[model samples]
Target: MKLELLASFFLLTTCFTAFSQEKQDTAVADKGLIKVSVMYPYAEGKTFNMEYYVTKHMPMVAAFLGANLVKYTIEKGLASGIPNQPLPFMAIGTFYVKSLSDYQAAIAPHGDAIRADFQNYTNIIPIILVSEVVN
Candidate 1:
């Protein structure tokens, strides 16, 4: 009976932890007015240099993107819902901006340089998305 109670307690704690983490993740997503996401899709067997991305690539983005870059989030996808399944994306990067015009203006001058840096990190082309934060 004691062992069963302990197991039940552990399960409840785990569930609560997962729930709170998911809530926190969603809250982060809701931040800022405009968001620009660059998602690198996962392949069956491929390589991505995460070290270079975080260290070199992101710093370059911040320097070139300028002060208009309100904030940014970089995510390294681990796994899918199902156990042992691969994640749909290798990495997902979001840049928070105040407006579309601001983002366009800031990125315009640096677009070529930003594109050029991709090879230093990963060979895969990322899919980009620009969206308004609703909520």
Candidate 2:
């Protein structure tokens, strides 16, 4: 009887340990790794040439930012919550980077030239964010 009790207790502890690990994995999956993002929001009556952005600007970004840039995504804001109203933003650009320091180190060297090309695309100053992905 004592041996059986010991065996059952061991099994119960093992099950709880496995359950704890599964819960931890789920939490991690719910909240992803840390990352950096650079977002460009639009303004009213702003002159933004999407053609130039896609052709000339993005290529320059990829070339200048270098390999530390994990990835990049481009979004065009369609409509806001209010019905029959224009969206607050026209376009938002996101860049997935390793960290703030990594981005600064990689792109600082080319900052001058990279910034200089801004006028060729849009007039609005971009909103940059260095943050983690928690979704």
Candidate 3:
């Protein structure tokens, strides 16, 4: 049941992101900007320490990425589209970079350290997506 819910959430999120960007300018899409999205699916009894995520984890990651990262956004899920439905995801963290290679290289050295810090923030495993920003 948990796996099914997670799969459904991912499918919906991917469709939404793709469709939303469909009408965007192709010229803008020419920029080789890469977006790295980390999403945490919501589940009963899951725990997420938002305070630690925002104040500590994110900042540490940003520092590690340094100049490779152009910008980033953090979102906390509230309610789903259907009334009284559970939020599909607990939170999302997205970071943009001019070059995927640069971002990869930047994070490579600190990858282990980064993963190790997850325990302080949330118990749920994150879903990571790497894609070219089509506007």
Candidate 4:
């Protein structure tokens, strides 16, 4: 009986330790910097042109900013609850940066280039939001 109890206790402790370690790993994985660019297009254009910008201009901007572009997703607003008319297409660009200052410095040189590129594309100014990953 004593041996069985000891074995159960050891197993329980091992399982608990494993669970704790997994939680810590998850926490660490969730801690990172994310920069999001919410891209909106001008109302008077065809979706084809917006798609072209996403395919062509996005890559150039990402490269110029020196950010690791993780993913780019296109989403449409259904029930977003925002005041403005729902954007036809919203391009979300996710980038990971080491720190806020690092992110700012990396994209600082590309400001003029970004503006120039935007002028060539659409008049709709994109909203950029930078956030730190917090779980």
Whose TM-score is greatest here?
3
Q: Write the per-residue lDDT of candidate 1 for residues 1-135, one digit (tens) a residue.
A: 999999999999999999999998976766657888999999966668999998888877877567777788899998887888778899998888777897798778999999998988887889999998875
Query: Clash totals for all models, in order?
Result: 0, 0, 0, 0
Residue 77 alpha-carbon offset, candidate 2, angstroms: 1.8
Q: Rank the candidates by TM-score, best first.
A: 3, 1, 2, 4
lDDT of 4 at 34: 66
Tens digit per residue, CA lDDT, model 4, 1-135: 999999999999999999999999966865774646564643555332456566777777667556444444454434335666655544444555556676577678888987787766566677667777785
Which pairs clash in the backbone of model 4?
Answer: none
In TM-score terms, candidate 2 sits at 0.66
Candidates in descending lDDT order? 3, 1, 2, 4
Which residue runs of candidate 3 sit more than 4 Å off their true CA positions?
1-31
Which digits, one per residue and each the tens of the lDDT, describe model 2 over residues 1-135? 999999999999999999999988865653543454445665677767778877787777877667667677677677777997767666766666555676778778888887899888888787776677665
What is the lDDT of every predicted structure here? 0.85, 0.72, 0.89, 0.63
Worst 10 residues of 3 by lDDT: 23-32
**Per-model TM-score on C-alpha atoms:** 0.73, 0.66, 0.75, 0.55
Q: Write the per-residue lDDT of candidate 3 for residues 87-107, one digit (tens) a residue.
A: 999999999888888889999
Give lDDT for model 1. 0.85
Error of 2 at 23 (Å): 19
When 2 and 4 are scored with TM-score, the better candidate is: 2
